[model samples]
Target: MAGGAADNYGGVFDGSMGFGAKPALILIDFVEAYFDPSCALYAGVEEALKNALKLRDAAREAGLLIVYTNVSYTQSMIDGGRFAQKVPPLENFVAGHPMGAWPKGLEPADDELVITKHYPSAFFGTSLASTLTANGNDSLIITGLSTSGCVRASCVDCCSHGFIPIIAEDAVGDRHEAPHKANLFDMQAKYADVLPSAKIMEYLSELKL
Candidate 1:
């Protein structure tokens, strides 16, 4: 760890953590396709979904912007690229499929933002950055499934876009625990602020969101 943020769990502070400002929330790939028991991301979907609900409530009460990233591909674009070849199973996630819909109880509110992405990184080839910038959001509280993939990619891109990426460790999930733990460690080491939800909530409460 280049900075002392890795010790932040015990009340250590780094000026870079971006706590006081109102943050936007980005929930990545929490749809039914990822939740299906047959999918590779299924194992921890239940836990992720529960945590996502918690994050949504907190963000809503804090008056922070809420954004949801749903991974969907049109049937015409099914054979897109290397990612599709690497995981042919994803072709089934075409738009309009029931499995591709946002999971029950997790739909975005009318005023919230919904970004449809064909790739893992939410900011890649999407309007996510512009949307956040337009709202004057400097910090993002991110949570969702498959922590090593979409979550990590989003965190890195969030930083690149000049926004602080705060990865809520407990609020994220993966197909297995090892990748989740490893990615969280790696993301905290260089790209983002990885912390538990309670501490983040405390920071947000004091911010005047």
Candidate 2:
């Protein structure tokens, strides 16, 4: 009999990069475009949003640095480059578009850092890595929309940038389940420590600031 998926890669890919001493919580692209049913990018990820909110509050209470990211592009999408060309739906993120606004309950606090990115990976073409390093953050608690796209990209880059990527599995979602689950499995095996939001919240609570 064949072993289960976990059994197949047990020793090779199952190693854990546990939480680091100084961690930051980053919410990626939890914008109105993903939550509004009328938007082309609507992902119906309300449950994920709820979980992210819980994690955000927990991280805030723990006094961890918090960062929120949103997609924004010039009207002509000059800075968007090939990404905007590949996905025309990105037009919704053009400056001043309603779809680019933050969803009500998920808005970043006044004091929280908000990074406006033009691409999928939050660290790509952005100062995220530098910001994290300067702030002495050794790890990131990552949560956001579209598990397979922005979330996965951010996780990989987080690892590449030498920051531990702790993905809040239930706090990230996609338009469909297949890619979401596949990406989470892949991330766990290669890039990040994929965990449930509740577990992440517990971890945050246990952190010493």
Candidate 3:
């Protein structure tokens, strides 16, 4: 049965921003902390990573500009500010920490851009918005860790910066299913066009290089 909430929000939040003429694929914070079982921030989201890799491959084949983000902080953790205080595990991203490193296959190519951010949103305190604008990208295909946190934040900022945000639903994961699903639903309703990774791959396949 369809949920009453979906019915309640029908038409109001069902609009789609759709894909744009120039879309960039941003693989956000696919770092070792979320992948390593022993890490405090481990999300056990291997499937999300797998799907994101597929998206990355499709974007590469489509010749779309690809961007990657990772959180980093100074050794003193001073730059992290209250965010670090709120989530002590963020120390995992301090410079030279193994958890801060990219996992095996997710490393950015030499020519690809990598943005280091101190906050949840990739655009905050980073060159992402300017870089995207300079590259002539009109939309962003966002995929990343923790749907309720960084992914949601980035999606909102992506829209606020005048770019259409297309979220790869299966390409983002949280520590639990509830926040993940809730954030996806919320983002779909308010900030982005949340579509399955396969759908996004299809879109990429149809794009002209």
Backbone clashes, each candidate: 0, 0, 0
Worst 10 residues of 3 by lDDT: 1-10
**How does residue 6 of candidate 3 score in lDDT?**
74
The candidate 1 region of ten consecutive residues with least summed lDDT is 9-18
Which lDDT values do the candidates have, in the order given? 0.81, 0.92, 0.93
Task: Check candidate 2 and list the clashing pairs.
Answer: none
Candidate 3: Cα lDDT at 98: 95
Question: Which pairs of residues collide in model 3?
Answer: none
Off by more than 4 A, model 3: 1-4
Per-residue lDDT for 51 in model 2? 90
For candidate 2, the TM-score is 0.96
Give the number of the best model, judged by TM-score: 3
Best by lDDT: 3
Tens-digit lDDT string for candidate 2 (1-209)? 14685688778997899999999999999999988898899999999999999988898899999999999888799999999989999999999999999889877788899999988999998999999999999999999988999999999999999999999999999999989988998999999999988888887788895
Q: Could you give me the TM-score of model 3 versus the true structure?
A: 0.97
How well is each residue in 72-148 modelled by candidate 3, as lDDT tens digits? 99999999999999999999998999999999999899989999999999999899999999999999999998899
